[model samples]
Target: MSPLLRSPLAGSGPDLCYPLLLNTSCRLSLGPRFSASLLYILTFSLALLTVLLNLLLIVSISHFRQLHTPTNMVLLSLAGSDLLIGLVVMPLGAQYYISSCWFLGPWLCSAFYMLSYVLTSASVASILLISLDRYLAVCQPLRYASEVTMGRVQLAVGLCWSCAVVYNGGLLGVNMRGPPRRTSCQGECVVVVDGSSDWLDFLVTFLAPISTVVALYLQVFAAALSQARKMRSSWAAAAVGAAAAARRSELKAARRLGVVVVVFLLCYFPSLGFMGEDVSVNSAASFWSTFLLHLNSCLNPLLYALFYPWFRWTIRLIVTLQILKPNSSRATVLH
Candidate 1:
């Protein structure tokens, strides 16, 4: 949904805060054969897949006791945020995409759009916090135990949620009333990312958080290497020093985190780049690129399972149980 076209419906008269809707309607007038059905199918399928995988991810993590840690709790919160996004935002976005219009009434439309933005913001913030936490653990392991407390994590999550609420909700108050028009037609409201708001969103949503993540990961990697060197120096003093093993694990974790950083950077920055430009030549490019940005949330659990051994073990246990479903009862009876 480019801001250029205010509304899909043409000849729509403005109601109370209806100018935006009319503008959207006017912009939505179609030209050629865009397969709404196919788009709906893909959109629905992605939404369903994202929901199912994220649900399984959350359930698996919750059920596995070994997976419980302050770090995993942050991941759990991330999963919850992504789950909300998949459940609430994706399907509705798909509907709007297919219909090329917002028929879901004005209030509902505004609320849905706002919620999508809020959840997305929260998810991004949570990811940044996770990176920060991991950096602390690897770089400052001794201090990490004290600093990254469960209470602190809870506070971080709360702050992320509050920031998302204020930022996204604030948009609702800054209404984007459309041009004065006389014709009456179906209407809806969408966030207007014009000159200032667009840059503001890019700064808050992508730039600042990305910078935080990059800096944290950089420090974490340097710290991990430093720790590794320190551990190697003491290898001769103690037989079977677990410090070396711990350093190895920390290095591996840092590498996995590097993947996350790369994914976040690759997925998100381009869209911001496009949006920040003056000319809207690549609006479709921006849309698809931003869509892929959301897809990052769905991809992370799988990446964790693949790259982190502990996560892999948890995933293996969950999958084994799922595969042995029919024999689960038999195993229970034998026990």
Candidate 2:
């Protein structure tokens, strides 16, 4: 929920965002003071958990030589965005919800929203790449490695981040150009967008990438089902040693990552469902939708821990500091 005040509860606060601003200030907006405190603690705890989990994922992927493949490269990229969401967005979001106030004030508020948009776009891009990689690996195993090389994956990640930055910068250009309108209550960083911009963002950031990801994963799922019934299916490509083994591995990864993609779509669809509607930020739908989106930032690492044996093993090694020993980067993670 936005740190914005509803008219009914406008009179309930001795605790205000900016007490010094008096009449103009937004109030710290929850029903009971104790509930607000509990909520803050809960939200912050989740954010911290998100940071730690994603950090582990980042360290595991970055520090391990054996983990450095096109698939892991894309994973590493996704983890980076997730880490930032935990580090930056989640805390800010928590404050926005608990206190219902933009404590950072005017310009930082715009930057904060812009950062969120960039991360959101970048995350969708990362998922799209992952889905594409899985599609190729499952649907066309013979061409997977050649098409999704490390160099190409890295280039794609760079391009995705760069484009996200540019796209969101332009998307929130009105706020980027100047402070939020003064008519807003103090401590409120309300960003009002025209219907045109709303539709544009919905299409670009939500519809297009999400649709592509779903479509690709559909193919991946189909190929997986076919391969499941027949190990010697055309999609799995019978070959000796590494080639065949690699195909099997790729097929497994596709299934695991499919879970990740499904969760992404589920979290996103609600949050972006009413893009054109000027919904009250304080509404239950608004609150739950925003909560779910932030919750998604933490879900991926949890999914990795649950699905990937390599990830669980690496976490143990890293936690035990076994990774500090000589030639540790060469240690086997994938079982």
Candidate 3:
């Protein structure tokens, strides 16, 4: 009966989700069969790409000692979460989007939702950590070396992940206790967040992080400009030439990181327009909004490859299988 259902086109009496169960099965929601197949193939392709790219990022950061630093550690965290998104969330989501049926039982369905939520939360935290790292590096360069050390950054990454797991677990706890929320029938699995969880998700995942990141980037760019001025002014000054060069390097790094943040904002900002009293996600707008958010994960590694020469070098090394050679981790990827 729904607009999404393809019972009329399929020429079957009705396309039940579980065709064997006449009394309990839900109707399949889909478009024309050819279009649906093409869409599924595209979605699966995206999932595969996302997985492969993020995996490369993870390996690049984890394997190369030169790539190990406070900033790269946060990137590692982001890549780790993105890898999970591509690995777990995207496949499950693709299946649901194409088939409009939940073959996995209620518990696994809830687990899927929770896992997706946690991984996304971790990505947000990692982005926030990145913002903070750049902020300190640019705005308070004097303290950056001491304050943003590897151990501290590692702990922060750990907290970012552990806290996401615990936080999202509590956020979805209420739904887990009760029966899974069905969209229309027995074969449907969806999370229908009530007023409170919706607001919490909006705030923690969207509002608070967005506000913090925007504020930090604003300051970072402002400071980077000041540093640029200092670099230009002190380039000829023998006493501060070293300082100017350092500041210039930091400025370049900040600009690269800024590109990452700006891309994330562009991808994520559309979702801000999505919140309202209507919680249904059965519309084109909802699907694209979510797809854009997931697309951010895929775009990130590409950005790194574009902005960071080290990333491209590592990719070449990784692709050529040179990483298997002894002490290849010590090979110069960064100039």
TM-score for each of the candidates: 0.77, 0.90, 0.92
Name the lDDT of candidate 3: 0.78
Q: Of 1 and 3, which scores higher on TM-score? A: 3
Stretches > 4 Å off in candidate 3: 1-13, 234-239
Question: Which order, best to worst by TM-score?
Answer: 3, 2, 1
Q: How well is each residue in 1-335 modelled by candidate 2, as lDDT tens digits?
A: 11121221234566788888888887766767687777778778988998999999999999999999998999999999989988998788667755657878788877777788888889989999999988888788768757778999999999999999998888789534698654367877656665687888888877788889889888878877765666656554553546656656778888899899989888877776657655554455665676688788899999999998889999999999999999999998876
Measured by TM-score, how close is model 2 to the native structure? 0.90
lDDT for each candidate structure: 0.63, 0.79, 0.78
For residue 108, model 3's alpha carbon misses the true position, in angstroms, by: 1.1
Ranking by lDDT: 2, 3, 1
Model 1, C-alpha of 203: deviation from truth (Å): 2.3
Give a tens-digit lDDT track for model 3, residues 149-249. 99999999998889998988887886467656545566777676666667777888878987999899899889876655655654354567777668778
Please say which candidate is ahead in lDDT: 2 or 3. 2
- Pairs of residues at least 3 apart in sequence or in different chains that clash in candidate 2: 3-100
lDDT of 1 by residue, 1-335 (tens): 12221222222223323346544342343223365455556667777777876777787667655555677777887888878767877777655543435666666766776777787788788779878877877877778877788788878888888988898777545643432122234543344455677677777887788789888888887876676566675655265467657756666766786786688667766555556454234434544665676677678777876776655554555667752465432221111
Query: Each prediction's Cα RMSD?
Result: 6.2, 3.1, 3.6
Q: Highest TM-score, which number?
A: 3
